[model samples]
Every structure is written in structure tokens, then in C-alpha cells.
Target: MIDIDLHMHSTCSDGLLEPEDLVNAAGRAGLGVIALCDHDSIAGVARAMAAGRARGVEVLTGVELSVAWQNWRDVHLLGYGIDLASPELLRCLATFAERRANRNREIVAAVNRRLDHEGRQPLDPDDVTALAGGVMGRPHIARALMARAYVASMEEAFDRYLVPCDVPKTYWPMEEAIAAIRRAGGAAVLAHPTSISTDFTVLERLVGGLAAIGLDGVEVYNSMASEAEAAFLQGLTRRHRLVTTAGSDFHGIDPGDTMGKGRGGIRFSGALLPPLYARIAERQEPL
Candidate 1:
């Protein structure tokens, strides 16, 4: 019974826990294998790997890259078994981090303007980043708003103010994300497809385009998906002959209190399944 959590974040991204803390928490939770799929950065992977080694847990070097398509659909591509030390990948990630910081600033300013119109004190980026404990994002802004009793929850914050359509920032395009993952010799898995948009036809088109662009997998069993949705995604994976993957998408310190630990206990079982450890090991093997 190998417990695997393929999608998790650390403070290297927006997650509450540091890399080492995340690994230790996974070990405490009885996870046999874990992937530190931090958003747009592998900066935490090495630290997680070290922690995993100490805890007897296998850590997979992974990342979750944000991809935007022409249809205004935001796609998240999860890369597994990537070379964390790749200079090219690191450089690209640095650019992405800079862009993300800029986007966060824009969102902060927008949220502040909205709050100020309501005669409320606005949150500064510094305060939001302090609350985030690292690079800030909409989630941090939402949390700050919640703390001030402005928004009831993260979902409300997004729905009212920070939705992509209303925000001034855009995600990196899909083709660019796919190419970066491919160049790193990593397998790209679509992360939590249902949460992005509700249109199944649009999702189908996105999956088709991603497959054509060399996408290796889809996260058919995500913590957020209902049982029926999970089954549907599994069917879609089969239909497309795509590698089906599962993940908890654990972001420590839940803001919405919607997504739970271990991705609602949806763990991958069986030796035949493509486990994160196996992928990392295969990548480590000499060619």
C-alpha cells in the first residue's frame, strides 16, 4: 500500500509550509511517495529531496507550470522527474517568478482600489507578502481581505474581485509551458482540469491540443473532483490514451477549506500505476 501524493506546494510557491516541513508532514501522514509540485519553481525540490531521504520517503522533483490558451482557459501543466538544476529551466522559472510578482502587485492594487471605494483600508503588497510568508498571490490577498472581514472566504474573494477576467494579469501560454516541460525531459500531467473551467467541450479541445503537443498525462483522480467527475476524467484519459495520474493538490494552510489533505484521500494504489518514485528513478538511470 504505497501512499502517493503527486501535487503539493511549499513556501517556495504559495504554500504555507517550507520544503522540509512539507516533506516531514507527508512522512507523518504516512505517505510513501510525494511530489513537491510547487508552482512554476523547482527551488524547493532539492530541500524536499533531502528531507525525504532523512524521513525514508521518496520525493519526486516536480513543478506545476501555469499555461494559458487562446480560449481564455488557464491550464496547469504538472511536470514530473524534471532536472531541477537545469540552467535553462531555472532561467525560465526566474522569468516566471518575476511575472508572477508583477501580477500579484496588479491584483493587490485592484483589490485595494475596490476596498478603498468601500471606505476600507487597503492591504499593501508587503503586508500581503508577509501573510503569504513568500511570493504573494491572489490567495494571500483573499486571506488578507478575509482577515479584515472584507470577504467571507477565498471563493467569495475570487468570485467578487480576483477572477481572471476581472484581473489585469494573464498566464503563460500553453505551447510555451509544454515546450519548457518537454525540454526538461519531464512528463507533463494536466493538473485538476475541472476546477479551471466548466465547459467539457472546451476541456476536450484543450486536452486534444495538449496531447498533440506531447502531454504525457492527465490528473484523472484529483482531490477536488467528485466521484462522477473523476470517473469521467478517467474515461477521457482512456479515450485519449493519455497516462492517467492522481494527486492530492495539497497546499498547506487551506484558505477556502474546500480542498483537503492528501487530495481527499485519493491515493494511487498498485505497482502497475505510474508512481512518482518510478519516474524519478527512471530519469536518474543512465541512458
Candidate 2:
């Protein structure tokens, strides 16, 4: 059984739960260890660590950065064992948050324009931010649209409107993100390559580029992967000689779907995974 669920979010980013609440939930769920891999933000790690310590659960420090490929496809890069206090990492994350905020605004504008054209009620930017818990994103927009009955579901919202191809938006440069992770003494792992719509050749090129820029691992088991997809990723990791990582990608409050919790039904022995726990201990050793 997987006792450690490594990819979770908190109110520090897009998740619905607060840091303490997330840690407590992990403990309640019988998770021995959990990592707070918030999106582009380490703000929740300290609180999560404190909560974990109090509950006799280990908390790993992590962040999921949004990186843009050459073709404008977005990839999530998970950085583990980062020195959250490192000035370079802090600076880079600040810039990323700023860019994400700008992108959120643009997405909101697009949504509003589309709604106006359709003669429907538009979403207020403030309501969208509230839905996002301060760090606005396309997911928040999707939720707002859903709340207003503009879309049937979150997947529909993305497929029909919010995804990058459906709207004009900018993404953070990939090379710079890799450099920032390296500067922070962290390991950058490619997160869920299946989400990128590309051929095998493009995927290989993307992985190669990331590896050249100091990428350390590839997520072989993700919440979204099928058994076959997971096997393919395992093969890809071996081919690239990249460290393997796996996670549930828990987003807390599942939006009409129960897919991202409790290992995401991707069963594996926690004892067999060395890199995941080793990275956790390495980061917690200093604190």
C-alpha cells in the first residue's frame, strides 16, 4: 500500500483546504507521510510541517512550477527538497506568481467576453479570486463558470474554453524554471507528461530539453495515468535514466470527481520507492 502521498495542494495555491487541515486530513487518512506540493508557492510548507510534526506524520517540502514548452504547451515541474528561504528561489517564485496572476486576469477577460457574446451572466474577477482562494487561475475560472451554470463541468470548461489553445495566454519559460530549481538546490521532476498533447518525438524532445537543463526525475505514476500509461512512463524514465516519482496529485475537495485522492488508485509498495522518501528526509533534516 502507498502510505506516502507526495503531491498535495493547500490554500497556498489552488487547493481548498488550509495547510493544517490538509495535514490533519492526511493523518486521519492513515497516511504516514505527505508532501505539500503547492503550485508555485511554498507558503504552506512551514505550517504543514508543524501540523505533521504534531500529528506524528512526516511532511516534505515541495512546489509545482508551471513551465512552458517551445510549442507553448504547459508542463508542471515538481521541485523537491528546495530551500524555501533561498533568495534566488524566492525571487523566481515571486516572478512566477506575478505572471500567473496576469494570466488569470487575461483568462477572466476572455471568459467575460465570451459570456457577453453569448448573452450570459459574466463572472466577477473578485468572485473568481475568492473561488481561487487568492491565487487565481483557469481552474478558478472554470469553477466560477460552473457555479453560474455556464458550463456543465470542469472538464467541459477546459475542453471547450479554458485550455491554452482555447484562449490567448502566455506561459513561463521552461529553461528559466529549470535554472531556478537548480539554484535552489532542488530536484526538478517532470510532472505528468501525458497531459501535454504531443507525439512521442515531441515528448522525447521535451524530456531531453528538460534533462539538459538539470531535470532530475519523471513522474512515472500520476493521478491521471492509466495502468498502461503508467507502464509507458516507467519505460520512458528508464530510457531517459531519470529518477522515478509518483503521486496522487490531491487537490482536496474533488469537483464532482473522486480521482485525485488515496493514491489515485495507482497501487504500489511504498517500501520500494527510495527516491521519494529520501528527498523528504533530506529536506527535513535541516529543520
Candidate 3:
């Protein structure tokens, strides 16, 4: 069966690989279908699509939107099969891009203030920008920290500075993000349902509410979910009649986060792709 990875990132977001390089890596991993779900930005989609063609791999137009739910700061929503030319969607994403940049800078500034006490040289914004493919985020900053010898690894960078120095991030409301995805002819899936809340009761309510409002699917198979958690999520999707997807949530900074196959040998069967495609097609229907 052909393997499919429905969620991942490129340098367009926090990922280490360039768009084409990511596609090439996916090709090497034998992923028949993959989606570049960069954080709030689809800038890499076009380039990845071109690379996909060259590699004979199917690249879906996707974006990982950060959404604000009730009392939740930044819940992730995965949008698949989005229309790249959707003006409203493009405008919405542009706002996210700007917000992310501002947040990155703010975090760097905070980190710099802390670095001042250590008597270490501060990181240049340009150095962080150099690491990003297009849209910059915290991972770029983490790389900047590593390059400056402020941290030994990405984990250390985040632990020592990135997390503590993080600034408030602005995001579209959950409803707005879901509506935008639908309007753009895409399937909006909840990424790693566990991230929203570990409590099954709370998660059920969230998923049920989102399904009522137009959530098309959930990430039932991912590096974040254990077999039991995946099974629970699968049941949740079944109850809500939502399509299910698998992804590595790969950024390529960690050695364990593989492209097609995620950590612990997670694999997605080709069966997951049909329902996802059908959901996207359903969204394309005129109201």
C-alpha cells in the first residue's frame, strides 16, 4: 500500500529542509502522497508541488493554521487541498505571517535581554532570517541560538530561552480558521487532537463542537499519539464522521522525526487518503 503523510513542515515554517529538498526527502522515503502543512503559510506549496512532479510524488496544497478556541491559545488546524489562489485565505495567512514575524522578533529581543546578563553576544535577526526558507518562526530563532553557541541543540535552545522568552502569539479564531479552509475548498482537520487537551472528556467536547461547525477530519496517526491514543482518536473520528489522517509532524531538526514514517515506525495506509480527498471535494461543492 502507498504511504501517505498528511502533515509536515518545510523551511517555510520551522522545518530545516527547503521546499524542494523536503519533497526530495519524501520521495526517497517512498511517500506516495504528502502535504506541506507549514504554519499559517503556504509559500512553499508551489515550489514543493514542482518538486513533487519531478519526484513522482503527490504534493497537496496544505497549511497548518493556528487557531484560538475557547480558552485555548494556539490550537493547530490542518487545512488540506486548499486553493492556493484564494484571496481571502491568502490575506488571512498574510496576517499570520506578520504576527509570527513579530512574535519571533519579540522572543529574540527577550532572549537578548537575558543574554546581556550572561555577557554573550546577542543574535542578529538576519542570522535567523537566513535559516528560514520564507516564513520565519521560533525554530529559526532556535537555530540562531545554536549557531551563536547559546545552546547545544534545538531542545536546549527551546528549554534555555525560546520557551521562556516566547511572546503572545495572535491567531485567527477557530471558527474563522475553519470557515477560511472551507471557503478555500479544503478539508480542515484537527492536528494532534491530544495537543488541544489530554482529557478525553474535554477532547470529546472540542471535537464534537468542531465537527458541528465544519471540522472535516482529525490527525489520528502521528508521532504525538501512541497506539492507544490513536485508537481513541480513531473512535472519536468515527463518532463524529470525520475523516482520519496520519503525519510525522516532521520539522527535520530531530533525528527521530522521519518524513513518511514517523517516530516509533508510524505508517499511514493508503486507505486514509480517499476519505480525505472526498472531504475536500465535498467542501468544494456550492452551498
Each prediction's TM-score versus the true structure = 0.81, 0.79, 0.96
Off by over 4 Å in 2: 116-121, 145-166, 197-209, 253-264, 276-287
Question: Could you give the candidate ranking by lDDT, starting with the highest?
Answer: 3, 1, 2
Worst 10 residues of 1 by lDDT: 255-264
lDDT of 2 at 54: 98
lDDT of 3 by residue, 22-57 (tens): 999998888999999999899999999999999999
Question: Global lDDT of each model?
Answer: 0.76, 0.74, 0.89
Query: Per-residue alpha-carbon lDDT of model 1 for 1-287, expressed as tens digits?
Result: 67667788888787768889989888887778878898877878999999999999888789998878777556788998888777788898888888888888888887778878889988877888787665566777778878888889877888877884255555778877877776776777899988876567877887887788777788877777777777777777778777777777877666532222324555565242555445445545677
| TM value for model 1 | 0.81
Question: Once model 2 is optimally superposed onto the true structure by TM-score, how far is the C-alpha of residue 208 displaced, in angstroms?
Answer: 4.2
| Pairs that collide, model 1 | 248-263
Which digits, one per residue and each the tens of the lDDT, describe model 2 over residues 1-287? 55777788887787767899999987887777777888888988999999999998888778998778677556888987777798988987787788778878878887778778888887898888877764666667887888888888878888767874244444567888877775676777888787774356666777777777777788767767767667776777778767787677777556532222423464434563577546445444644
> For residue 208, what is the lDDT in candidate 1?
81
The CA lDDT at 135 in model 2 is: 63
- Show where candidate 1 strays beyond 4 Å: 70-72, 118-120, 145-166, 196-204, 255-265, 270-287
